[model samples]
Target: MSDAEVWTFNVDDYAAKLQCPTLIIHGERSDGFEAAAQHVFRKVPAQNKKLIIVDGVFHTRFYDDPLVIEPTATEVAKWFKDNVK
Candidate 1:
């Protein structure tokens, strides 16, 4: 968890190195999250990568809210179906 802190380290290098089918899902209302998510989405090298913006939700809430999580789960499942063998 300590290694994941943005203040301590950066992932842009790793983001640029991604070679797998990537799925980027984030909520619509986060203050600075959308831009960061888009930045990572742009860096992914995978041809089959996707960026999904979930509606009526915000960053942390997307993880816990049933209303938001269910639909987001559907999108995740679809991404796996289309990208995974």
Candidate 2:
């Protein structure tokens, strides 16, 4: 898929179909995705769902910075630990 295709993909359209446990993690400074992430979170039908916003981190930092990655990884692990069955 191309970047254009990814840009066109409306995750909200598939949010209701997320019947399984879902973990929505984003950076606090992800101005572009934060609202959309929250929207998807609200739309998801999963009984077990969560949204985590890592402090002082931007979208890309969530993938790179060690300070940001550690706690975020912990959160991801905890989410999987609590949700994956």
Which pairs of residues collide in model 1?
A: none
lDDT of each: 0.84, 0.85
lDDT of 1 at 35: 85
Candidate 1, residues 1-85, lDDT tens digits: the string is 5655767666788889999898888887887688899998999988888999877578887778898888888888987988899
RMSD of each: 1.8, 1.4
Q: lDDT tens string, model 2, 1-85? A: 8999998988888998999988888887887778877888999998888888776778999777898888888888988888797
- RMSD (CA, angstroms), candidate 1: 1.8
Clashes of each: 0, 0
Residue 38 C-alpha lDDT in model 1: 93
Error of 2 at 43 (Å): 0.9
Judging by lDDT against the true structure, name the best candidate. 2
